[model samples]
Target chain A: MSGFDVGGRLKQLRMQRDLSQRELAKRAGVTNSTISLIEQNSVSPSVSSLKKILDALPVTISEFFAGEEVSREQVFYRASELTEIGDGVLSWRLIGARRPNRRMSILHERYPPGADTGEDMLEHDGEEGGVIISGTIELTVNGEVQLLTAGDAYYFDSRLPHRFRNVSDSECIIVSANNPPSFSDGGDAQHHA
Target chain B: MSGFDVGGRLKQLRMQRDLSQRELAKRAGVTNSTISLIEQNSVSPSVSSLKKILDALPVTISEFFAGEEVSREQVFYRASELTEIGDGVLSWRLIGARRPNRRMSILHERYPPGADTGEDMLEHDGEEGGVIISGTIELTVNGEVQLLTAGDAYYFDSRLPHRFRNVSDSECIIVSANNPPSFSDGGDAQHHA
Candidate 1:
């Protein structure tokens, strides 16, 4: 946490919302002078104080801490720039993992034939939605299942428990979105192909 | 707003935050029975009451209204699925336009050599970030200019006026993300190539 530009980031956050220091201070329950002081890097605010201010922006402490990580991350990603994770059966290419406070998880996911999301149903936070760019995928959500084809799409509550399977004899490509970004987390499972 | 499934959407919104009816009612400063009646479609909620309920989830009325449109939309998009706009100089492929309360704008952008983002600089709300997937392009942000090649990325506050130009001899491919999903919505311009 040393050398973290808390002031600069705070200013950026405030500005991102188009909020003035006075407005933000009011929202954070802090004084205008405190906001000015913090932005000027004059004082090292306590974690609690910082949390109070940050909560107004609604960013979590984890994301606040991860802000530095995003600064070191590249602004753009090409095909080779994607963070790739695969289980020999499926390939997940994650985009924009370095964006600070990423509110969305966008992935280029590929499932080879006969691949299944293991024996257990996959469950997680947030909602999951995707469009089938190619091939066919059998999607099961909360005991309801369907075989989706090219151009088919599904959006569901992730907490309902779901499993993705490529039961056909071809590869499937999906551009999937997960709000609040459930990636590299438990959502990527060791599948049974 | 006739035929709107306010109850179902309200229930989904409450469940999205993993909040129980009792808890959400408390947050909205309303009785649990009010929430129940609303969710059960027993009564039509006043706009003000609905606003109070929606505010607890921190979603805008516009987004809440847009929910029905999203439900009527497809989940997947092929190349043909993308909503495209360009001026013969650049091609922008917008993804996931149908998603409700879209928090991210993901674009597959192509800039032909000599293409530029117009004479006037571009400014918008939120941040803009993308990677140079292929070829070389010159970027200018707040008068700071640089040339980026494949794998090079930039992320900046979009409030700082910026411009893009492909001065190279070949075409350029980029994957750009705009937070809060600015698309088909004035970012496109009659760019001079």
Candidate 2:
């Protein structure tokens, strides 16, 4: 679960749905070799390719990552149990790891001073909302810049080109949530395609 | 913020957007009287009507209920601070009330033994997903019946006719979340129209 076992997970899901590799490839509008390479972990499928495959299975991106066997009794998640993703100056603490069937991805995120999402900006499907927990961050959504301080919240469709940066000389904290969880590392704009 | 001050909240949002009641009514495709009655707190708007109004404002139902003045610094909510909305054998503990511009409504719900949502099934716009925390419950979604137990989860489009009942002798607990929060009390199916 630490590293994204996309191949293993995809194979599992495909089998679970009783879909053959050729069948899945046809359904996903991809070549058989593409599915084969993905299943064999020989190639990293682009975000678009992965999305097409998942859509063919009729499973969401969040469900694809939740894995096949999810515990039924596990409810509350402790702060320590949060799955930490992202690196460098940005940190994302994701709630409810190993919990199945998540519709939303709730993240307690932090960006160190001067940290930025990069020059490329970010784009994805679904909607994103967050409350600025502490410090200040400059948010640019589709060329509109807004300086959001602690207590200020923002909601926007993720399809817009958006980027976040800690404009202040202090670490910024944000309680962000996204519907139909965008499973991309924020650095790559291509991940959104 | 404790009670659903939908009327006051709608008026505030309408004014904030610099839209008159007539303008909002026109955009929402409802009669001006409908908007007036909703804002005056004289009539409870149906889900469809409320959705139309919110869509005209281009805000999600979750954002509408997050209220006008949401503080950015208010990130964490203690268990005691959860807003209790449902009555009778059903109780819903809603999280992140003071945080503004919410896109999702996360709830910790409880249903006592023999409790049911009612004879009439519920339907609404948006998607819902929940994990059964404890005990057993029977879920009927669009004529399909599912007996879900602890750790089991359900996710479906809220527009599907759905109902839930605690079939076991013990109390049932569910941690549920919905995109674009359904503000209506579940007992009234008329609210859906």
Q: Chain B, TM-score, each prediction? A: 0.61, 0.58
Classified by CAPRI criteria, candidate 1 counts as: incorrect
Report the Cα lDDT for residue A187, model 2: 38
Q: Give the worst 10-residue stretch by lDDT in candidate 1 chain B.
A: B184-193
Give lDDT tens digits, candidate 2, residues A1-193. 1145668878977886789999999998988899898888777665456667877875544445432332242334444555677576588766553444444666667889998888898976556666565788888887778888765566666667789988889999766667656543343313321
Task: Provide the interface RMSD of candidate 1 in angstroms, 1 decimal place.
Answer: 10.8
- Each model's TM-score? 0.50, 0.38
RMSD of 2: 20.2
Error of 2 at A189 (Å): 12
lDDT of 2 by residue, B64-124 (tens): 5432332233333434555677676688766554333345666667889998988899875
lDDT of 2 at A16: 65
Q: Using lDDT, give the best candidate's number.
A: 1
For model 1, residues A1-193, the per-residue Cα lDDT tens digits are: 2345768878987886789988988988989998898888777674456657877875544345432332333444556767777767788777666554555566678899998886688876555566665799998877777888865566655666678999999999766666546764344532221
Worst 10 residues of 2 chain A by lDDT: A184-193
